[model samples]
Target: TGGSNAFAAPEAFQTRSSSRPSPPPRPDLSSLASSAAPEQHAVSSVPEQKAATEAGVLPLYKIALCCLLTDLKINCRDSLLVSRAQAPSLPGYLDLVEALQQRVAAAAELKDVAALCSVFSGFLRNSLLPSSCSPDVQVRLLHALAEVGLDQRRE
Candidate 1:
């Protein structure tokens, strides 16, 4: 029986064939070299072409500034109060206001109130103000705290 089994295994091995045919040789790439040159040229000129095409478009900063100004004008129209004082009492009030406005505009553009709140929180945390502060400062802080609370509640 063992002899017969060994003879059958040899026959099986002799009759075995590959399941798939061998692949053909790689084609010559020399013919495609000339076509590749034009593709590379087209790719290289893409940015210059894009710049030429976009020349008529408004700059991004200008567009953002326009949108921010329009939004502020519409939303903050009622909040704009004419003070009797000739100059601001605080030295950096104008700068602070401008910074806050820019931050608000950026936040509005990105539709991210949490980022704005985090930024304000960091500012307040790092500020030189003490716990016992003026009423105006206390009111502003309270407003910020309320806004953060509301944002948390919404989430």
Candidate 2:
């Protein structure tokens, strides 16, 4: 037979050509560390609380509680639900409810409905519905959401 043998000698093997390109050189971060200014470190290392205060941002949980109180007021006004009484018995609820009560009372005392509305809107935009809220609270929140939708449609 004129055909070449299927089994070649071991010495006849050849390396396959690689399609991948050589990897780029690694960056020299050691030089960057040595050259970084103290001011850069100071700015980067600012404490989160200090940064938040400077930016006039409230803590997320407080904002959520404020939104919840606003929703309760809008939907449960006839019930005259007390913030403390309505708050679900859960960790952190007491402090949040108390803070919300104080804020609402202060707003009412100042007779600043516009400011109260603004704060409520701000909080609502940032708020999250807590998984621990009672079914009653959830239903009230749904009603509040529907009211908001109707108001938006009217406007």
Candidate 3:
């Protein structure tokens, strides 16, 4: 070998100066876009889905479960699966709750007992909206109320 320091690195890296590294060359975006399948470009074009894909919070059910458990005076913080980073804002949740309320109200107005019953059943069965209130009695009471509502005149 020539009289050179074995410890010194060879020009394995391209550098602007002996001590300074230059930035890596930018990739040819046009070539990349052209080379990629058409579907890949389509997915990236939709900003909402692209953003959601890049960053995401936990599922809605987890948030609902936590809130439901909290309302029932159950401590679940120790077992929470979502971090603060993943938690959605309370303001954002208001719209979601309102939408759900409106849906339930519509079902009631339409006398869709099955839809209403499904919601009732979900309250008891699904972890999303569990309640401490007497579900069986409440359900029977709700059933009777709906029946009575059927006989009432529209205002």
Top model number, TM-score: 2
Clashing residue pairs found in predicted model 3: none
The per-candidate count of clashes, in order, stands at 0, 0, 0
Per-residue alpha-carbon lDDT of candidate 3 for residues 1-155, written as tens digits (9 for 90 to 100): 12332222224322323456668999987776666677766744576765564334223333443354344223322222133233233443334334344443444222333333333334423333323333443233233333334433232
The residue-by-residue lDDT of candidate 1 on 5-100, one tens digit each, is 111122333344233467998888666567555657455477676665554332433344334334333433223223213223332333433454
Candidate 2 lDDT over residue span 1-155, tens digit each? 11332222123122211334779998896666755677765544457656656445444434444656655544443333344355333334334444445654444222223333333442343233322344454444334434433443366
Q: Between candidates 1 and 2, which one is better according to lDDT?
A: 2
TM-score between model 3 and native: 0.23
- Candidate lDDT scores, in order, read 0.38, 0.42, 0.37
Which is the better candidate, 2 or 3, if ranked by TM-score? 2
Task: Give candidate 3 regions above 4 Å deviation.
Answer: 1-83, 108-123, 126-155
Give the TM-score comparing model 1 with the true structure, all chains together. 0.23
